[model samples]
Every structure is written in structure tokens, then in C-alpha cells.
Target: MPKFAVVVCPHCKNAFIMEPGHKTVSCRSCNKRLEASRLKVFFASDDFKEAQAARGSVVAGISGDTAAFEEALPGIGRDVMERIGEDVQEQRYMEDKRKVNEKMDEEARKTKKKGQQAILRDTFEELAENGDIDIEEYWKKISFSGIDRLKFDKWVEKLVETGVAYSPRFGYLRKS
Candidate 1:
């Protein structure tokens, strides 16, 4: 038995484990074979460094006084900052929804199901009618095994592909 760490294939971009003593493995994404020695280990320490670098880059890019935004506004209490944050979040949500709709429209033009479209349509319709669809709850209701999340995601992708469901501001919504 050899120790292994999950690595993303540079050639195909698929995630695969790098087993010790194995020099190469086929990528699950593009099926391109990649050398294990070329893979980079993304450990917690590496992740921390990456986060720190990203934060530093963002801070460096901002020219104005970042502290000014942190100060409390006139006639508003501590909740003012929270409210602004919420508003910004809502804007981001709307932007993301627009992008999803565009992606769904594009996917609908494609001619193939990729094997999960029917199931996805049923699930999306059910969720749209109910106005709520928690992944865990859906799994429980359907009696899915632990591995079913992958299947569910695939189905969701198909639904998106067929333009039957689009993740909007609050949750998944059907195209009207």
C-alpha cells in the first residue's frame, strides 16, 4: 500500500490521487495521461499561502483608503455595515443568476442528454413546485446512498443543460 494525495491533472484538469511509486496515471477529465512527478500537492499549508497571496494582491490593488469603508456611517449603527454587505451579496446573487441563465440557454441548444436529463427534469420540476430543495433532504426523501451526490450533481447539470432549471437569486428556478 502506498500513500497518495489527490492532485489535479495539469494536462486534463481532472482530480486524481498520486500513488507513491506510480510514475503516471490517466486523467478522468480528458483521459490524457499525466506524470505523477509533475503534479503539485495542494495541502492546507499551500492553501493558506495561496489565500494570503490573493488577499495581499487585492489589498495592493486598491488605491483608496480601505479603512474608510470600515467606519460607521452617520445615522446608522453597527447594522449599517451589515446592511451594505447584504446589499452587495444580493447584487452578486443577481449577477450569478444571469450567468446561470445564459449557460442554461446555451446548454439547451445542445442535442444530447449525457444520460441524466430526464431524471434532472423531474427533480427540477419537483423542486420548483415545492419552492425548496435541500440536497440532504432530497437525498433522504429519495433514499439515496452516500455516493448519490455525484449522481444528483450530474442530474442537476443535465437540468441546467436542458434549460429546465436555473439557479437564481434565492434558489433553483424553472425557466418561465
Candidate 2:
């Protein structure tokens, strides 16, 4: 057989076979124009095919005859299985890291929420005790950091909704 080349389009993910003389081809999936001149194709030799077959049979003996498993073992089935095992281990490690990050994020959110509520409550109590409140001055005295802007806005909105804060002539006042 003449050494035909197979090209897979990255944009449309279509696979096509081309002969030696063909310089360009279009992808069937996206119907987009493509140049086949730069396409590179690699084919396994007969020796490789035999090795793959032997590996497949050995894997079959271990895993039993599953159609999906058989279909996956095209060449170097043992190497494929070893790679899959490594991939699974890496995936598990990544999943554990993901869970840890999620937990840390949750804890940080809770701490931030609690601190916001405490600040709001303390500010209200101080104004009430003094019998004179300056909204701008009070806000200026308070500091908010280490909190995400969106989360902080949400917390402030919740306080306003619950009558914990209200707009005054100057800026904002705490509800008594």
C-alpha cells in the first residue's frame, strides 16, 4: 500500500486520510478550509502490531474480555495499562488537594462573615452609647481587609436588609 497520511483537524476534530499527491484537504466536522500540506502521520510496523497483540492477550487474561478494554489496547497495551494506573493515582492526589482547598476556602469565608457581623454590631453599640453618631466618621474609623469585595458587598447588603444599617443625611447610620 502507498504510504497514505491521516490528518486530524484541531479546530473541528475531524480525521481524514489523504494520499501522497494531495496538498490540501478540508475538515468534514466543521466544513472549514484546511491545508493538508503540513499534516504528519505515523504508522506502526508489523513488529509493533505483534507486540500490541501479545500485550492485549496478556491484559485480557488479567482483566477478562471486555469490549471497551479490548478496543483501547491498540498498541503497547501493557504500557497503556501502566500509564492508566499512574493517571489514576495522579487524579486521586489532585482530588485530595482540591478538597483541602475547598475546606480552607469555606473556613475563610466563615471567619470573614463572622468578623463583618461583629464589626457592624460593635459600631452600632458604640454609637448608641455615645448618643451622637457621625456616619462618615464611623465608617472611616472602621477597616475592612482580607475579605473579597463581592462577599463584603453581600454582607453589607444583608445588614441593610435586616435594618442593621440605614442611609442617613451624610452616609450610613446603624439601626438602634
Candidate 3:
């Protein structure tokens, strides 16, 4: 097997492992043709895996990540790899949580635009106990619906006109 060499491309500065003895090699990143003999070699090894590790170190160094470059060196241990796996998992978890929150926000916006008075009416219906809604309780529950008292009164008037609800007394309303 031809011994592999870890080299950096002069044009793009990206590192990659390649075999020696070739007259020319194309840079993996920039695709520029370079004379193999002229290219600066960072490391050379008979083992392809060792050359790959050296290439990783060179790439990490080029990216300005010191920790990753150090991890690419031999005798780093499996604990570092495990930590990288955990970090990736945590990133994915956070991304998933953000997506869920965005979806909930979108759903809330759709519900908010559906019609405030309609939501308030539904809330009033839900607030009704024993088939009669206490005006005070209904007002308290629909506070978040953004419907003002005048608007609610007009809506209630419309409801009574449309035969959907009726005022049984001064402080209670019931659906007809």
C-alpha cells in the first residue's frame, strides 16, 4: 500500500489525506490542480487511519478550533467522543423544543384571529354553572379574550336578538 500524506491545499487551506508519488493532485475543497511534490505535507504515515487523524487535526486547526485539534491527536480517550455525542443530542433537543414552542405560538395566533367575541361566547358558555352564567364570573373568564365591556354588551345584544342567549335576571345569562 502506498503511504498516505496529510496535506493542506494552498488555495483554500483545507486539509485532506492523499497518497504520495502522484505527479499532481486536485484540491478537495478548491478543485485546483497542484503538484504533489510541491505541496507542503503536514504528516505522512503508512497507516491510512493515522493519516486520516492527522488530516482531521489539520482541518480542525484551519477552522480555528483548538479543542477539536487537540482531540484529533492520539490517546485522547473515548470520554471526549462521548461528550461530543451528548453535546449533539442536547443541541437537537433544544432545536426540537424551539420548534414545538413556535408551533404552539402559531396555533395561539390562529386562535386569537378566529374571532374574539366568538371565543368570549364559548368562554361564557363554559362558565355557566347549572345552565346559568354569572355575569361576574363570565366577565372574569373572558378578560383574556381582549373584548371590552361595551363590545361584549353589543355582542350580547346581538346574541339576544339572534335568539342564541337570554338574560334570565339582572346578574345571569342563559343560552336559549
Candidate 4:
């Protein structure tokens, strides 16, 4: 078996060399993600220099040079003019499963954000009492406010500075 393959991009018809074993490769010229097992291996060789020369020949052949193509065709040791069709079925199933998982993750994130916003809007100031507040409790009540812990701490500091609220202790707040 060859360590490297000279394959042509099915989308752009450009030739490039790649190592096998990976599930996919991005076409160098077209920037398209290609399943490596599905591409036609134009030439295969264990030597990188040999693969490069084969790629050059494939490029020349695509550029309308029939003589270069004919010369290169004879050098293909095995599976000449055949698709590298190993694991094609399994690859299709995995690709579909990956896309479905991504979509489910996105939907989960969106639903969680909306639920957090509703919780904050409903329960925020209800946790306060008698013009005094627990900073940690307030932060928990407003978790959907999209402010992280550091930002909440900075907000508390700003409130104290502006006389809107004051911190009498490290974790307590009072209205001014």
C-alpha cells in the first residue's frame, strides 16, 4: 500500500497529493472539504517525491497535455482509474450523524438562553428585602442577565461608587 496518494479534486478537477488514513481532506485549489475515501487516486506511491512527480503529471494532463497523461497512466501500479471507495457507506452515515448532533446542540443552547432570560426577568428583584441584598443571591436570581461573575462584581462596584447601592460587607448590598 502507498503512504501517499496523488488525487484529483472532484469539484475543481485540480490535482494534489495527500496522505491517506484521514477521513477527509480540503482541496488545495478549491477549498472544498472532500471525503478522502471517495476521491479517485490518480497515482499512489510510498515515496513523497514520486507522488509529487505524479501530481505534476496529473496537473499537466488536466492542462491539455495528452502525452504526459498517457505516460503517467502506465505508472499506476494498482487500482488504476478506480475510486478509492473504502468505507464509503460508513463515512456517509457518520457525516449525517455529525450534522444532526450539531443542530441539536445549537437548539439546546438557544432554548437554555431563553429560559435563563425568563428566570431573571421573573425572579430578579423578588429576592431582595428591606432595601438590603445578598450579592451572591442577587447574582443567582439574575443569572439570565448575560453578565458573568466578573462583570457582576464590577457592576456592584460601580453601583457603590455612584451611590445607587452600597456594600457594607464583602457579600452584602444596601440601597442608598
Which residues of candidate 2, in runs, are more than 4 Å off? 1-87, 145-175
lDDT tens string, model 3, 1-176? 45998777767767788899999999988999999999776667787877777677666666657688768866434554344334334544665698899999999988876778578767866765469887777777776768788877777678778988889998778888
- Residue 108 C-alpha lDDT in model 3: 94
Per residue, candidate 1 scores C-alpha lDDT tens digits across 1-176 of 32544454554434444454678777777888778677654211223333333223222222223354344233334453444434334544665698899999778655334324444555556766777566555555444422356777676566568875665645344454
**Of models 1 and 3, which has the larger lDDT?**
3
RMSD of each: 22.9, 8.8, 12.7, 10.4
* Number of backbone-clashing residue pairs for each candidate, in the order shown: 0, 0, 0, 0
TM-score (C-alpha, index-matched) for candidate 2: 0.38
Greater-lDDT candidate between 1 and 2 = 2
Score residue 55 of candidate 1 by CA lDDT.
27
lDDT per residue, candidate 2, 69-167, as tens digits? 446456555664454434333444665698899999999989877887777567657875765456545555454534455654565567668876665
TM-score of 3: 0.41
**Which runs of model 4 end up more than 4 angstroms from their true locations?**
70-176
Best by lDDT: 3
What would the per-residue lDDT of candidate 4 be over residues 59-118, giving only the tens digit for each residue?
A: 755665656655654545435422222222233356569889999999999987777555
TM-score of each: 0.26, 0.38, 0.41, 0.40
Total backbone clashes of candidate 3, pairs 3 or more residues apart or in separate chains: 0
Model 3 residue runs over 4 Å out of place are: 75-176
Return the top candidate by TM-score. 3
Candidates' C-alpha lDDT: 0.49, 0.54, 0.73, 0.69
Candidate 4 weakest lDDT stretch, 10 residues: 81-90
Model 1 earns a TM-score of 0.26
